[model samples]
Structures are given as C-alpha cells and as structure tokens.
Target: MYAQPQPQTTGRYIDLFPYIPWLLTGGMVFALIFGALWERTMVSTNLLVNPDTAAELKPIQLKKEPIGALRIDVNASISYNQWVTYEIQVKDQQGKVLASGIKQAWAESGTWVEEGESGTWAENDLMGGLDVRANQSEPVIIAIDVLEYSDTAGKEIDKPVSFQVIVKNGVVDDRYLWTGLFGTLLLSVLALFTVSSTGKVVINKSNPDSDVVARAICGNKDRLIRVVVKVQSDEYSPSSLHIRLTVNDANGEQLYSQTHLVNVKRSKSDGKVTSGSSALTTFFVLEPRGSYGFHAEVTPDASVDRTRIIVRENARTLFPVKVVTLKSSDAQ
Candidate 1:
C-alpha cells in the first residue's frame, strides 16, 4: 500500500523586492566613487604663476583616445625686444631623461602661435618676442606627446610620463610696477564708488550668494572690482533703471560715488518692458587682506517721459570680503 504519497517538501526562496531600492542606491554610490577615481587617473594639470612667470602643465588621457598629448602654457612679461626660451624634460625617480624639447618663440609677433607639431619642438626662430605697449604679457603654449612610457620607479608603463618645466633666459618685466601705478590712478577717478555715511550702510551679516551679473568694470594698475546692481521694481510699471554706487574705506570715509541710468526698452506691439543688465568695473591699488564695502541704490522709473523720476527703494550693501592674492603655490 502506497502509504499515502509522501508529502512533498519545498524550501522557501528569499525575495529581493523589499531590498531592490536599497541595493540599487548603494550600487549607484559605489559607481560614483569609482568613476571619480578612474577619471583622476586619466588626466592632470599643474599651474605655477607669479609676477615674473605663469606656467601650466596638462597631461592628456590615452585610455580611450588613440594618441596621447601633453599641453603646456607659459605666460611671461617680455619687454619690448627681449627674448626668452624654455625647456621641458621628463625624468624618472632616478632622474633619467626620457624625453626632451625646447620651447619655440615666434618671430613676427615674437610669441608662440598654434603651428602644427614639428617633431618634439618647433623651429628655432619662433621663440623670440617683443612685448607690445598695450599688451605686455605674452602667452605661450607647447603641446607634446608621450615619446615613451615608464613608471616613476623606471618600470615600463603604458601611461603618459610626468615632467618638469624649466624656464631659461627669462626676465621679469621691469615696467610691470609702473603699469600698475598708472592704471590705479586712472580707474579711481572714473569707476570707483564713494558713499557717504548719511546714505546707508546695510551690513550683510551672512552674505548669501545673489544672482547678479558682473564683468570687468575698471582697474587700478593691477587690481579691479566688478559691479552688478539688481533692481527690484519699486513701481508697478517702471520705465527705467537708476543705480547709485558708493565706496567706503575702513574709517567709513566715502572714497567715490557715481550714478548710472539705464533706459528700459519696451516692445512696440504690447509695450512690455524688456529685461536688461548693467555692469561696471573699477581698478585701484587695493591693499592685501584689506576689507572694502560697496553700497548700491537701485530705482525703477515709471515716468511716461524719459526725463521724469520714478519711485526709489532703500540702498543694499554686499558683504565685504578681504582681497587675497592668488599664487601658483595655491594650485594643485
């Protein structure tokens, strides 16, 4: 007698439904970290800049690209009729030169121009230069390739080799200081702001980043500040934009003040106001680590005639930040 067909036993399997979202989230996080690491291994850049020299080195990635490339940029203030040359070399940890080339200076302009690759270096005469009065600092770029690959320990590797940039026969421009001095005096009179204590000093305790557009307004010989005024409509139908700027010193002395008027444009068909932006630049001799304050008054005119005045709002001030000089040593 078949003692009742033996009861079938089945094992339960784990379901992934509840854990799928968490697993996917963890996988995405892992992928992001891995992608960042892989990208870092592909390409890298080093920059060095100072009053005398500015240099940058960029190594190209060859993992996906068939041909490897290295780009170098050098900025130097060469005086009129002065000439300089540069040299690049790739050395292993033991200081073995794997590749060597000389920077070519151009003749007609006396600066390097984009000419196709000629071996590792360019023609000899292309490296010379004479700085123009208006444009003193000349920019030079050198692009090379991985002649051979090797590790820092001297073992053969399939990656781009690392190198150092050395400047030879280079001189610091003597006229640089003079240029800065003249520039500061000119910008102080034109674009700088000077506000009186009577107007307003709205200190921004927490400087929240605002959406404003600013471009190079003006400069003292070497330093400049950009200004952008955001005018919220004071009147329902403002016809124009008026901005007043004031610059104050540490002791609260007003150094400068200026008023700017921007005419509003309207569409002929519907008379709708068109949006616009205004920017101003000022250059001056700014002391390092010094705090400067900028205050602005924005008004929207609602007059039907261009000459009439419109309602105005209280002035606004941006949080003051110290001016810090940027150095090549700061770059990684």
Candidate 2:
C-alpha cells in the first residue's frame, strides 16, 4: 500500500503531437522538391541554334576544278518558342563580307517539325524560309567559287576564311509566350517544393552540372553530341553504387549504352558512405536530315529505388533523338 504507483506521465505523448504539425510541414516541403526534380527543373529548355560559328578557306588550284563552296547547316531548335530566324553570312578570313550571289540556301518543304516537341506542319512551311518554327532545321549551302578568286596581293590566298551562321533574329507567338513563365514556375516549384533523391541521373546539354536541356546538333554528319549523365548515391550507405545505362532509337533499336559504377568512401568518425557522385559522358551521331527517335534508359542497383532515378522522359524514362542533315547542292 505504501508503494502506490504515481500517475503515468502523458507529457511525453503530448509533446510529440505538437511536432506532428512540424513533421507534416517538413514532409510537404520535401514532396514539393521531389516533384520539381522529377519534372527536370520544369521541362523548359532553350531554343538552340547549332554551329554558332564556322570558318574554313583554301586557295584555288585549278579553274576547271570549279570554285569550292562553304556548305554549312544552320539549325534552330525551337523548344520554348514557335518561331526563330537564322541569318547566314559568308566572309573571307579578312572579315570582309562576301557576295550573297555565291551563297544559296534551299530547304525541302514540310520536312520537319519542332526538334523536341510535336506539332502539325503545312506544305507551305518548310526549312527554306527565313521564318523558322519550333523543331525545324535546314541546311544553308554557301558556295564560294575558288576559281574566280582574285587575291588582293595577287598572291596565293593562304588564310583561314570563315563562314558565319547566326540566330540573328527570333520572334515567338504571343500565345506560346507563356512557356517562359510556365517553365520558370515549373523550375521554381522544383527548387522550393521537392527534395532531391539519392541515386538519381540528370541529363544536361553539354555538361553534367549544366542545366538539363534537349539540344539540337547540326553541321557535319559526323558531328557528335556529347551528353553528360550525373548520378548520386546515399551518403550513409555501406555499399558502392552501380548504374547501367542503355540508349535506343525511336524504332527501339539500340544505338549506344553502357554501365558506370561509383565507389563510396566513409569518414572514420561517421562510418557512413558519405555522399557520392559519378558523371558519365556519351556521344550520339547526328544522322542525315530527318527526324529520328532516340532515348536513354538508366538502371541503378537493386538496392536503389527506380523512382529515385531522374531522367528526361517522364513516363518511359527514355531520351528522345532527332537527326538533321547538312549538305551542299551537289551532295543534296
């Protein structure tokens, strides 16, 4: 009777209930970050124009051999806009403007659509015109006749001549202008609302640390598009990370694929894996002028959840590929 038990303390349980709101708030914040990352910083990329600059020149050897021409493919990727303009210029190594008569630009009508996005095209709208729309790309053939060459010094012209292709002008429809805003919001939501996941892969235009974008590679047929895939692993895990990647064409034909592994090191004090990262680089060849499908698949170790992987494609988790051709009149 003297050892009666005191009332059990309920304060411990009450204190945890207050933290319930905090825990819920923290969870909501993390979910928003995850959503943004999954969306790839808003799915909004840039309107890219390839071969920002080009230059090549040689001396004429023979009159009958015909004047050589500088053939360059001017390509504009309309990812966020509907239309843009490309201005082509031919110049000597001296920076003097060459005559337009030596330059010729031709494009096949109804040959393309926006590079990454989808849309309908009419016969009148082709790569030939100055007004370029989303997903459309064409080659501009600049033929500089070496046979008619007249050097200023009357000597062998042995200088590196240059040809310039630029995205001199761009105009977007008012309706589609919202893409910029929407894209920003999408990214903002990603940054503010979602938490980054471990064991994730991010595809960027040129480098792993750069902004992720679907790029348009133009110019030479053998030109290569370098893509960087960045992967991450848990800081506290005990095991190393292994990531396998596969690339395929739109027809489901395999193009290129490989697997990468990252080793984890732990601190002596923490005895944890410590955060780890691995960057992988792969190249894709640009094909002749025609839209083609291409994508990449990433598979992490069984221990890492599949949902933790971040990729460009939302549902299929594959990257898309498109090819455009650049050729001279003779070659075309």
Candidate 3:
C-alpha cells in the first residue's frame, strides 16, 4: 500500500509572527533616541523681572527649518506659597507680535495627618513651553511681562523674580513618539497570546492503562511535540509520583527518554478537600518526517486511581526554545 504525503505546514511563519511587534518596539526606541540627539539648543539665558516691569531680551536670529519648527521653554523661580502670572511674546524686528500667550507658576508646602499617620508634603510646579514655526529666517525678540504676583492666600507681593528661558531647534514632539511606543508595547504583549499557534491532540485518554502507547505523524521537522501526563488520586495517595516518558522512531529505535517526579496537591473547593492530582510535561522535536511512537509508564501504579495522557503535535510555546543536540539524546 502506498503511503499518503503529509500536508504542508506554515508552522515556521506562525512562530515568527510574534516577533514583529517587538521589532516595531525596537524601531521606536531607536527613533526616540535619535530624535533626542538631533535637537540643538539655540538660546539659553536668564531674565530678571520686577513686580511691574517687562524684561526684553536682545534680538535672536532664527533659521527656519524645511520640515519642523522650534520650541521655547520658560521656567520661573518663586518663593514658597507664592504665584506669578506672566505674558510671553515673540515679535519681529518691526515690533509686530507674531505669537503671544499668558502663563503662571506657583509653589506650596504643608503637613497632613491621615489614618493616624503624619507627614509633611510639598508641591511646586513652574514651567511652560511654546512651539514656533517661523515662516522665514529673520531676527526676533522675546518679551516677558509680569502681570500679577501674589501669595496663595490672595495677598499681593512686591518682589523681583528670576526666569530661565530656552529655545531649541529640531524639537521633536514626544507626544506622538510616546503614544506610538505605548501602542507598540501593547501589541507586543498581545502577540504573545494571539499569534501563538496551537497543536493538534494526538491522544487524550482518561484512566489510561499503566503502560500506554500511541503513534503520531510529524508534518514539519522544525516543530515541537508535547507530552502531558496527569495522575489523579485521593487524600490517601502518596505525596509524589514518578513518571517515565519515551519516544521511538518508526523503526522501534528509541530517540528520547526522561523521568520526572510530580508533586501531588489536594484540590480544595468551598474550603473542603477534594481529589488530588499531579501532572508532568515534556517537549521534544522530531527531525525526521515520519511516524513516531510515544510510551508512558508510572511507578507505584497503586498510588494513582486514574491517569490521563495527552500527546500534541506542532506545539508552539509562549517563548522561543533553544534546541541543543547531543550525541545520545534528542529532547530538551
């Protein structure tokens, strides 16, 4: 009788699908690093401001980019529990206001006791930024006008404050980068579960005999096979069970053999003791495209009241396996 050919398998491609998201994540990391390095500081200076005076800085020459724009950042230093509101403006050499906005900064501190635990707390936030896309290369001026200065209790304060101003070229909008990275990471996590392929069950028998045997065919030489054995008993059973698993080629030549000691745990339901069960699992790859035999046996068979043997072909695990070959073994 002529033997039928096995079906073509796409197991290799399926196994590689899970890594695509990780590759995207790596690319995102590279882009983020490159963007941070590409940015250059165009201006860094400090301005002193009185309660009712506007600080005007020297003219700054800015070059317009063909693709992206520049960024302006301002930070204020104020006393505790005090707040300052200021107006920022970017003007052309002719004193025309091209862009303008109002911003505020404040700092506060206090102590609190909650749930019998006491601690001191302090919070201070002081920074603002703006994006500018120059239509053409020109000289411009940056002006800061302090509008109001007061304490948190609505008391006016008369004082001089220092402000740090910064202008940067090639500024990258990290909002999109961060959003893309977050989405890619989520996809990578989901791929671990959705992209993995499941195997076909070759044998699923309950209450199997002490020495059970089954035969299965290997469609792909690169795919893995899994063997799972479950033993069930009662409270009187022993604490552990010893199991032996063996795989043989079509010619009755042993290819793999291993022994495992599985610890039995009594299952509980509604705070009551139930049946006890223990399981043993092993994985191996069959390189030859042909039929193979699986054998399983349990020691001290009297300790197990029921048994189950599950053999699966083309098994895909959550993580990649590193296969190592030895002169006398073919399992890992």
Give the best candidate by TM-score.
3
What would the per-residue lDDT of candidate 2 be over residues 183-299, giving only the tens digit for each residue? 545555543322222112233333232122232223235443334455443454434554454443334444344455655343343654545555554333334432333233334
TM-score order of candidates, top first = 3, 2, 1
lDDT of 1 by residue, 22-122 (tens): 45445555544543343222223333332123233342222222221222233322223323343444333344444456554322223443676333322
By descending lDDT, how would the candidates be arranged? Answer: 3, 1, 2
Please provide TM-scores, in order, for all candidate models, with all chains considered together: 0.23, 0.24, 0.66
lDDT (C-alpha, whole model) for all candidates: 0.33, 0.33, 0.74
What TM-score should be assigned to candidate 3?
Answer: 0.66
Worst 10 residues of 1 by lDDT: 308-317
TM-score quality measure for candidate 2:
0.24
